[model samples]
Each structure stands twice: as C-alpha cells, then as structure tokens.
Target: MAKLLLCSLAWFTFPSFADNKPLNSPVDYLSVLLSLVVVIAMVFMLGYLMRRFNVTQHGGGQMKVVGSMALGTRERILVIQVGEEQHMLGVTAQNINHLARLETPLEVPQASGDNFKNKLSQLMQGHKGKTDE
Candidate 1:
C-alpha cells in the first residue's frame, strides 16, 4: 500500500517537460502582433466615424457660445448667439439663469497680430508713467 501511494504521488507531483516545445512559435507572435494592429486600427476608425458624424460636437446649428466670463470659482456668464438674437446667461455649478437678451448682437472680436505679452508690457509702462506723475 505504501509503495503504491508513493508511486502515485511521484507520478502526479512532477510535470513532464520531455516534449520541451516552445510556448509561442513565430506564427503565434505574428498573429498576436496582427491582432494588436487590427484593434488599434479599429479604434482609429471608430474615432473617425464619430468625428465624421459630429457625434460629440456641440452648438453646430443656430446656437453658439460667443463669449464667456468667469464670475467666481464655479460661476460663469455666457453670451450665446442664436440666429439674430443674443442672450446672456448666468451659470453656476448647480443652476443656470437667464440674465438678459441683447437687442443688438455683440460683435465677436477678431484676433489681431499684436501679441498679448507686448500689450501687457505697454499697459505696465503706462501705469508706471501715471504713478511717476
């Protein structure tokens, strides 16, 4: 009985590596690489489809955010243009309220060639001259 038990234990205890085959062949590696490439291509294709369909875009047709101002930490004022009319909205973290509607729509400013740093330096110089006088 002891001999039978020892023989059975030894038979099950050790894994046989006599076959000694490598886990992944070159073809296996190539298949894995091809699968990864296919997955990445699918992700990019999905992104392209989403953008082409404008799935995640906002304010496309009449309504548009013309300007916004930060009031506090989590509060803002937004000027939105819808067709010919403009509306000012007060927005907070928890609530949105209509402030006013402008009779004439505000013109959106165009970006000029003047850099912000140059304008800031000019403003600082003007303030210094005023303080000296």
Candidate 2:
C-alpha cells in the first residue's frame, strides 16, 4: 500500500518537472481572446439592433381575435391582433374550446372612412383629456 501511494504521488508530480511551455504562443492566446470578445460584442450588437428595430414584440395585450378558421376537424387557425399588429397562429380544438369562454368579437370592424390624421387627432385629444383629468 505504501509503494502504491508513492508510485501514485510520483505519477501526479512527474508532469510538474516537465517543460512548462504553453500549448499556444502568447500572440495565439491573445488572438483567440480577441476573437471571443469580438463574437460576444457582435452578438450583443445584434441583440441591441433587434431591440432598436422592435423586431421581438409578440403576443401580449388586449388581443383581438380576428378569426378561428378550421385547419382539420380538430385543429384551427387562430388569428389574433396585438396592438396594431396581427398574427395568425395554429390552435387545436382544445384551445378553440378554451377561447370560446373569452369575450372575442364575432367580427372586427372596418374603419368608417377614418384616416391616419383623424386617428392621430383623436389620440392627441385623448392624451390631452387624460392630462387635464
């Protein structure tokens, strides 16, 4: 047992006596570190760009259920609106049954000759009323 322990200790320490040369040159290590940093920076930059462009907004709010069209006998397409954006999502009969409990409009109303300027004016008026209140 003593011999075995000594042999094991020697085996562990033997590598420490060998030449301590780094596997990669200093320049190579620096290049690798720089590449890693650049990759991380690029990833963060891409994320920032996506956020700036509002590319990640989805599926949250007083969603307007546009339609529930049949896909199969059991599955259907569920079209929903989040803010001004619309999304058509696939849903099963289970989801359709669940959706039936919610106060979804039978039909979304079309703009009654109201243009962008009128909408903007209405929004501004609403904002002014809120501020006054």
Candidate 3:
C-alpha cells in the first residue's frame, strides 16, 4: 500500500516538475510583446483623443476671483478687444454681473498680473459689502 501511494505521488509531482521549465517558444514571447505594445498604444491614443476633442476646445481663457461674494462658481475674466479699446468683463454662473470694467483694458496683460489680481480682489470685496448690507 505504501509503494502504491508513493508511486501515485511521484507521478503527480513529475508532471508539476515539467511545468517549471521556462517557456521556450518564439510565439509566446511575440504574443507577450505584442500585448504590451497594444496596451501602451491604446493609452497614448486615449490621451490624444481627450486633448483633441475635450481639452483644447473648451479649457482655455479662465480666471479666478481673489475674494468676493461669488463663493462657488466658475468665474471667467474676459478681455474683449474692440479696436483700440479693451473691455474686462467678469462673467459669473448666474449672469453677466459686472464685476469691473477696465477703461483701457490694460494692454491685454497675462492672466497672472498685479492689475488683474487687484481688480478681482476689489470686486469681491465690494460684492461682499453689498451682500452684508
């Protein structure tokens, strides 16, 4: 009985030992490399699609107000150029509530500037005062 049990165990263990041999087929290596390439290409394609369709179309020209009554909403600070004059408009979610209007539009300055920051901060302060009153 011991011999029979040992024989069966040896047979089962022999098959498992064969499985430890490294995969030696070119087909297996090619399949693995192809799968990796496909996954990387898919990731890059998805990113490109997102940039082309979603981000580039609608993710430009946004401004943030420093301190104001407009607590939670996307504020867009627009510098509209009409000939030599530029108009600064703060458009809130509710309506085109005039936060501040620049007389000369300050030469289409970059989004980050002392003038823009000061104006946005002052507008917010004024809006807060009005709401408190």
For candidate 3, report its TM-score.
0.30
Write candidate 1's Cα lDDT for 6-104 as tens digits: 455434432232234443566645654665576578779989998886577565588878899998999999998888899999999999999999988
Lowest summed lDDT over 10 consecutive residues: which window, candidate 1? 10-19
The residue-by-residue lDDT of candidate 2 on 41-89, one tens digit each, is: 8779989998886576643357766666786888887767666556667
- Please tell me which model should have the higher lDDT, number 1 or number 2: 1
Candidate 1 ranges with C-alpha deviation above 4 Å: 1-56, 109-133
All candidates: CA RMSD in angstroms?
A: 19.9, 18.6, 20.3
Query: Cα lDDT of all candidates, in order?
Result: 0.73, 0.61, 0.58
Tell me how far candidate 3 lies from the true structure as C-alpha RMSD in angstroms. 20.3
Off by over 4 Å in 2: 1-22, 58-133
Pairs that collide in candidate 1 are: none
Task: Rank candidates, TM-score, best first.
Answer: 1, 3, 2
Q: Number of clashing pairs, model 3?
A: 1
Best-performing candidate as measured by TM-score: 1
Candidate 3, residue 54: Cα displacement in angstroms equals 2.7
